[model samples]
Target: MTTKSSLNAAPRRFALINDRIITAPKEVVPVSVLRALASIAADQVLVRDHGSPNDMVLDDRATVDLNDGNVFYTRARCDATPPAACGSPAKLAFAVDDTFELSTAAELPFEAFMALFGLEAGKQLFRDFESPNDQPVAPGSVLRFKDGPVFYTRGGQHHDARVEITIDGVKHKVAPGKTSGADLKKIGNVPLADELIQNIGGKLTPLADDATLCIAGGEEFVSHPRCGASS
Candidate 1:
């Protein structure tokens, strides 16, 4: 159970691939390896453990893990002064059983990959899913083969996964679950007097401020000034 005081007292923090200051919803979270690495381009990432000498690398990942009460930084695995994509990408595709949703690059770090077959648990990433099973690879080892790192599950739990959404014309990631209309407004910072419109199947639908949304991921939203107050 999260309280406002809890969020205020301790905010889990990390930086986006664009270096945006992001607040984590949990103390420690598991992120999708495919998405994380893709956030950065041209190179692999090295994750420095929050206040320790240990470091982790991402072979194809551009994202980093978020830990509560800690801050982590990402670096490249290459010898280049600023780091650049030195190794070629390996094709990686993942799915819940056979319903593959995301197809991406390769040879990602172990810590970088999120499993139980879901990115994380609380956000309802995959229903009843735990974590990804252990593989023969080590955390620091590289598995850049040309084939598939493709994933599958026995009982499909690929419900609403985290997806990319557009708020006010800017793309943002939306975690799947019961969403409040206010939450969407906060995502795009829509004003109290403004309105949010959802474009679905080429149809324009006005979203209510009190509505609850079950996001299917990859949805688009637009904001505009309210025409008039509701009767």
Candidate 2:
């Protein structure tokens, strides 16, 4: 079983790409070649498709099925809704058996294409690449350092309380107000928590509301006892 402490210690990062394969040395390969390599099952592979405005293609994937002969892919698709369609891009995910291969139609080198797979993972990958300082926390988020990174939920809607911090150096998601207290305790060392709570209350606080603190882009509201309603 993978322990939280051990998992947090591992290194991972995120890289952005249009349609390419990212290699161990952090090189970008064409998407076609990446698809071919994935067909053969490469180790520790990540694939992503940063959609272009005119292309209308969606692809964002991450996978680690090398030795066993499995390929995984993810797609992040843009929604047709007004804001989502205009602002957000489309995404998708895919997984295939090792027997798969890049079709002859592809034009890029396999190595170059593989680089695109790791974009989302690249963010965490960058964290893993950099020396461990404080774990990356959103500006207005409160982070409680226990045996690992523990996120606490301020009172709101009742949701899953147990939260697990990823020690693998990979980024894990913890819903803003949905994580459980039991989850926070599992991280241990609850007393040593730190808060980046913003003064503004509510999910969408205007930047002018709190001059004392600046909010990060796309920050959701998280309520804390000491910080009140923060991002």
Candidate 3:
């Protein structure tokens, strides 16, 4: 009986990004060998075999990083097995020397700017007016009050009455006129929307002439992205 040689006895190199595989060198090489080499180099790798002009298969295979900070990804495809419908040809293009950067928590915006990432404050305050229910404000719930500058009360005493209230460490000021508690509640819950106005040193405009309300944060908000991408 005749014996068949291993298809991937020798490997080739290639580069990949943006879902497109770089063409291999002019010299013919075994596809399996190229995949094996790539798998060895990256923590995660993908291969696409374009054995035919029209057919492609994206083989999702990758290596995992245990202690290393790098992320690897790969895909593969083959052309000879089915209808000729693949998008491109398989070829070695170039070598990818990637430098991975670690993402730190410091990159996230402060609580005052949480609105940019769609996060809301856990606790908020309404100035001047009293809540209909005589209950301590709950976390993660909106608090409403009547419009006008809020009079800060300390030790059962009314302090300086100002439109601005410092929540946690973030400062939110009310508009000059009256606003309903409902309107203030909506503004506090929208971190991005409010922060945008606050950052510009602008006032939160009243929804209606009869509206009067304000909101303040309890603590600074912070966010961090678990990971990011780069070439």
Candidate 4:
């Protein structure tokens, strides 16, 4: 029965529950609804697994906080299979600018994906972008099953085959995405004994030889001689 007090309660909230999503009704969620939303049975257990230190059981809880992303998992009450019986890790295959798709099993967030690939805000991920009616993928979305799924991206940021950077006032075009300081040095033909530095906001920042960098256009780099004044 709908009551005036319940209607006047706080707004409803959404949370990720065991590969599925659920919403709280007036800040208080019933267990039945939670299971229904998660496609789990009543006998299943909702666990908050973190580490060996402490793992809380969430089945007894009625309300979960929002504002911060809420994540929960559901497991069988009794497990006959061994720990090693778990299924294979999920794999997500994605590509940008109609490039070949690459698979990843890591639970990497969308922001990290953008940074690693030098993707900009305009770059958007979608399902079946080749089709007439394509669907847009929400940021931070995940595919949890062990089966590998593919997605596509389209945007101007991914259209560029190479990024143009200036090294010691010399312009060079290099592949976009993750790069190492050694690769930049090689591209600039800097002496092996010299150190590589990046120029940003008029400040010179040192770059490690093996350091991974997200290549972008118009980036300025300088090579400094390693030898210092002899005392």
Candidate 5:
């Protein structure tokens, strides 16, 4: 006769982030969430197969599979140039749901840029205005118009696609592609995104009620309704 297995099964191993090992029944978890679990900071955290070269750096979309031995290791990464340099290409890429996306490349076609914003190719897209320096993007490009600036319409108002940055207690709006050390200087004197994170004493995961939340797409700050104590 056949027998049924017990319902209380053991949790499966997911993947290792840094020295910590994560095990869960779920098949996948966002890299950002995993970094938080391992106490590692954002953007620079590199996840790779347990033992592999730097070329295998896993993006935010990497998944941990229990059946395939998808073990991983996480470490902070750095670029050789100083944060104050200008015209540097974005070094990382990430997606924000189906509404928006970002990628790291020296230069991409206008079609490629539109695709990131969920725009259809070969369509009569309505741009707010013609950019002055509109041209093919080059390697090591920043948010300059030569790299094909993106525009969007909201409530019949035109706007450029940009991100948020906080410097010395002041928040500023900046382009998402401009998170590099050089790109950040357009608004104010600020350290590299990674540098700021390191200076803040690594990833902030405290049991206190005044913890900070660092969201993806640069240093933007947003309020989470559930994060605060209710009245």
Candidate 6:
């Protein structure tokens, strides 16, 4: 019989991917491959265990196998420089996956905090606003350290929240505010459907709002289905 003390005594396990180590549990479970890929956010190929291709599938479900060394290598772009070596003008500190981390900030024009992170303008910073969007906040306004890479994803709505849905028939989830044609394709590892399908109230509906994250799986309307073969 397993006791609470024994469970506590077990050391946590982690899998290393693209330099980031992600927590893994004793039980194998499904995780979003796209999300993990997005975390790297680089134009390059990834290989696992030296030779195995680290490719994401339509289902996008993956398990971090502890038996394997859980190693991944990136074939980064030739022209691209690692953020750490970019000689950023400032640094921002934040927490990702309960791990405190830092990132370099671009030495460019001062803008809103979210804008600093390449987000759409007018998105609030840490869900707060000191002034209107037109009023730009100077660089380093959001971080106390103000000397390394800017870690601002922790301030956005999509920090941990993702919208799950079934595209065609596979189950997958994309980060909030990223449900559009181009974004969904990248996240779901599949082609964009000529016709958008969404589940709503035990019925299927034409997916009109591709910008918001409130979407979920619903029933398709059998008669005059909005997202069916008739479309």
Clashes of each: 11, 56, 37, 0, 1, 13
Identify the runs in model 3 with alpha carbons over 4 angstroms from their true place.
Answer: 1-26, 40-55, 58-83, 87-231
Which model, 1 or 2, shows the larger lDDT? 1
Candidate 3: tens digits of C-alpha lDDT, residues 93-206: 221122111221212222322232233453232222233111112223321111111111212123222345433235554333443434343334433223212221344322
Worst 10-residue lDDT window for candidate 2 reads 143-152
- For candidate 4, write residues 1-53 as lDDT tens digits: 11111112232244456544354443345555666677777667765433222
Report the C-alpha lDDT of model 5 over 1-231, residue by residue, as the tens digit: 111111222222234444344443354566666666666666364544423233245566555433333344555666312223223332322111212233445344545555656644333322212221112222222322221223333221233344455644567653343133333332344432322321233453222122333323345322222334568
Q: Rank all candidate structures by their lDDT, best first, as comma-separated numbers.
A: 4, 1, 5, 6, 3, 2
Candidate 3 residue 119 Cα shift, in angstroms, is: 40
Tens digits of per-residue lDDT, candidate 2, 26-101, equal 2233344454544533332333222434322223233322221112343333331122232322232211111112
- Worst lDDT run of 10 residues, candidate 1, spans 127-136
Look at candidate 1 and tell me the lDDT of residue 69: 19
- The candidate 3 region of ten consecutive residues with least summed lDDT is 143-152
lDDT of 3 at 57: 33
The CA lDDT of each predicted structure is: 0.44, 0.27, 0.29, 0.53, 0.37, 0.36
**Model 5: lDDT of residue 95:** 18
lDDT of 1 by residue, 1-231 (tens): 111111112322232332333333443444444234336444545443323333334334344333211223456547424433333222223333333322233344433444424543222222112211111222344323122223322222334344677888888665556666667887777886788889998899988988887777777888899676679
- Residue 8 of model 2 has an lDDT of 39
- Give per-model TM-scores: 0.32, 0.19, 0.17, 0.32, 0.27, 0.26
Q: Model 4: residues >4 Å from true position, as ranges?
A: 1-160
In model 1, the Cα lDDT at residue 35 comes to 34
Shift in Å, residue 65, candidate 4: 60
